[model samples]
Target: MGKAKYLSAVEQGMVVGARRTGLSVSRTATLLCFSCSTFYQELPHKLTEQDRQLLKCVLHKNHLSSVTTLTTEYQTASGSNVSTKTVRRELHEMGFHGRAATHKTKITMHCPNSLLEW
Candidate 1:
């Protein structure tokens, strides 16, 4: 219900460097343009146990294609509502990206020259 707790990569690196330079948590947070309390609150990622289990299920399943489909399947199986944006953002955080799938390639490529090189 609070503002989403997100720090950019630069901010995260700066936070680490601030600690290394012996900046107090309060000063460091101030330098980063946010309150010390917010810094502490946002510092540790609080992935709930339920979210972890659901995310694990999502990552391990190959049948899933898009976040739209993923959210639908998750809601059906878990009886809960999770947004496509939440799934998409979390997927990005979890090191997964979405790209349009092209049907140009078959299961096997017919490049004999490339196959011979392999």
Candidate 2:
């Protein structure tokens, strides 16, 4: 019930496997090749200068670019590699769905049908 460290699904599965095998935490940590303290501690990733520049360019100029475009541009401009998925994930975290607009038909709405005949 206490605060859980930031473990991925794979790491969680590893922990579960260790528990199922009746190995001690230290043993599990050893098997994973990471210190027990490191396993339990959360290490947050800070944004790099390139990432800050990306955010800045997007916000300052109202930039609208696809994940592929962003990644291509970023690599060209910053001389670093970036995956399209990472760009997309960052956009989603920033509340951008990376879509022009979501489609919704009138049939999906529950408005009064009589309005259609009027």
Task: Identify the candidate with maximal TM-score.
Answer: 2
The TM-score values for the models, in the order shown, are 0.42, 0.44
Residue 34 lDDT in model 2?
58
Score each candidate by Cα lDDT. Answer: 0.73, 0.67
Q: Write the per-residue lDDT of candidate 2 for residues 1-118, one digit (tens) a residue.
A: 5555577778878877886899987898889875677564643324575685675575445467556776677667667676877666666666767456878866766669798878
On lDDT, the leading prediction is: 1
lDDT of 1 by residue, 14-95 (tens): 8989989999998898888877766665565434558757875976794457678887776777776778777676677777
After superposing candidate 2 on the true structure, give the runs of residues whose Cα lies further than 4 Å from its correct spot: 6-50, 58-62, 104-118
Model 1 TM-score?
Answer: 0.42
Model 2: per-residue Cα lDDT at residue 48? 72
Evaluate model 2: give its lDDT. 0.67
TM-score: model 2 vs. ground truth: 0.44
- Displacement of residue 15 (Cα, Å) in model 1 is 20
